[model samples]
Target: MAARLRRRLALVALVRVFKPGTPGVGRRLAAVPRLIAATLRGQYDGAARLATMAVAAIYLVSPFDFIGVAIFLIVGVLGDAALVTWLAGALMDETERFLEWERGSGRRPVA
Candidate 1:
């Protein structure tokens, strides 16, 4: 009941965060570097997400994969694509959260 409602709300929020043509695409893209910098500088707010993103990145490059290359090449490629898609969504969600935190904490840029 309560947990299900929370899950539903979270799904809705995730969709809202990553919807295509959402404004600030450039700003969001720019935030990737900033996010990395912040994470490296010891900001732990998004450390878990950053760690997952890093692992996804490493999996993309690593020769060994859960879906082995020797197995169907198409399946391996599809697995990689799925991982990339998840990575992109995760990045967007984390960046949106970071932006919200920045605004609420008086770190918003002067306009």
Candidate 2:
């Protein structure tokens, strides 16, 4: 559904990622390497989801062009725009989780 897709985009989350706080964009970006290391070492539990988001990000800048723009500029760009929004929001959330995992604080796993 279009409404669900729009919610997935979460442009506001992209903006909020940069807001000053414990999980700001600067801190999030800083943790990426550690996150990857932890995942590869089997210390983190969200590897699959992280890989999916990484692929989405790589595809966004990928020259192969998932949605060719030559004939459908608007549609093609919109597709990338939507992917960007989704990736940004997902990154914010994933990084927040990683940060909590790092400090051993914040939300606990649902029981």
- For all candidates in order, the CA lDDT equals 0.64, 0.69
Candidate 2 Cα errors over 4 Å, as ranges: 1-12, 18-20, 105-111
Cα lDDT of model 2 by residue, 3-104, tens digit: 111122346667767677647777778888777887898877768868999899777777766557556899988878888778878777777767677667
lDDT of 1 by residue, 1-111 (tens): 111111123234446664675536567777777667766877526677688779989988887875585587888878887777777666666777666555565665433
> What is the lDDT for 33 in model 2?
78
Judged by lDDT, which candidate is best? 2
- Candidate achieving the largest TM-score: 2
* TM-score of each candidate structure, all chains considered together: 0.70, 0.72
